[model samples]
Target: MSAMTTTPRTVTVRTSAAGFVGGIWHFARREFRDAIASKWFILYTIAFTVLAVGVSFLSLSGVGSHGFAGFGRTAAGLLNLIMLVVPLMALTAGAGSIAGERERGTLLYLLAQPVSRTQLLLGKYLGLAAALVCSLCIGFGVSAVVLAWRADGVGTGSFAMLMSFTAMLALSMLSLGMLISVISRRTGVATGVGLFTWLTLVFVSDLGLMASSIIFKLRVQEIFGLAALNPLQSFKMAVIVNMNASLDVLGPVGAYASQTLGGALPWLLASSLLAWTLAPLGLAMLLFGRRSSV
Candidate 1:
């Protein structure tokens, strides 16, 4: 006291902000790790390898001596295979992301760490998206390489473009899965809902197009525009249109929409895909951050 007391106060500040890119990497890595560790995805990959070998063999048959059907059929078949498998990857990767965290009692611990809610969401999305990319590239790469070993190679560019559109499709699927995980309280419930959602989006969407054709009195142009709002239609449209560039197998309305609203299909597809991915995670973060897990 006589020496004049000196007092010190300790201060701790936690900004917990990683730049956006870092968040993306962090999330992307998490997705890869999760996918690698998951037994189900591993099993699926093995099965996929077997099927890809068979498909590659057939697609590569008589390489240099084929008509248009050979090339077209091979391309179409390969695209179909990609379309089928990629969604499963997306669904399995994302279906359990947040809900499973809650199941494991680590949601609190993760949030309590030096990471903000947004970072958690973005990181997870990025991780999941990266995993999706890996799945697609690996599947596509295997097919491309095997086909190329012969006298004539598959159209790598066409395969790549088709994959690009498929990846975009996966983006929407993954986001929806994540939202289901975040919204649902139980992992099993999330998973069931996720699968159902995937099935409906993938298969039942055509019903929507048919319904529009039957119900609406609108011109062909407006019908396609409205249908484009259905994410699945956009997904297929992106793939088909990009694959052929002039193939409007989608019909006059589809062609018109492509000329008009669907013309920005790339940007719109990206936006919608990202929206589905981000929105659920955003909601998950909000719920998780304030959630009474205690």
Candidate 2:
């Protein structure tokens, strides 16, 4: 008689409570490196630098000709440019993020890893944010240096506030683009949606407010509330208020918001922008979590 013995099979599995953070960092690093390497990033940086320099010089020579030099004048002059440009850049970059990954067939591979969807989403957002913020800082920093040299000196406080507001605007747009990316099945669709969103929020929204007021006889408070729904409007108001610019420039809505919201308008607008940055991301996380990698 022969006795046969079966060896027990051993399986090893690794788990960590803090592994999510590590996963996020790993993906974030990868995304950041990839973003910086893209030709689009290079072109974007150059364009931003050139435009910023041109605007600064024009302000110095033209607007500063009136003895308006320093951060306030420079920032106020650059506000329209930054508001127009930063959102477009952010939307373009973010619109292609997840959708492009899926289109390229890399998303499945990414999902094959042990990382959770939330971690991956957060990592991607943070990575893109870092790249965008870097470009913004470099472009604006160069202008700031020029302003310092040409003008009496830049207003440190106003410059900082402008940068902060610009960063928030970029973040808000990025979050919106990510939401679109998650919802879209193709990169092309995502890009189209992103552009449309930018146009609606930036241009059409204001027109819509005007039309609504004219047609419906909406009050200043109502218009202001509606405008606040658009992140871009909130951003502009925040910048204007923070710069201590005249509220009359904003017209009735401005007057109403200033009186009703009072000094809290800036804080409220900032909080609104923060919410704009976060809410879409949270929604995207939920959607991506529910979706299958296949």
**True-structure lDDT of candidate 1:** 0.67
Candidate 2, superposed: residue stretches over 4 Å from native: 1-12, 62-69
lDDT of 1 at 293: 54
Best by the lDDT measure: 2
* RMSD to the hidden true structure, all candidates: 5.7, 5.0
- Total colliding residue pairs, candidate 2: 0
lDDT of candidate 2 at residue 61, scale 0 to 100: 77
Per residue, candidate 1 scores C-alpha lDDT tens digits across 1-294 of: 388666886877644434556665676687668876778666766666667756767865765533333445566666666556667667766778878887888877877776666677667877777766766666667766666665255665666776777777777777777777777787899899988876776677667667867887678866765666666666666666666663367677656656775556556655665665566656666765575652
lDDT agreement with native, every candidate: 0.67, 0.85
TM-score winner: 2
lDDT string for model 2 (206-256, tens) is: 899889999999988888888888888888899888777435578777877
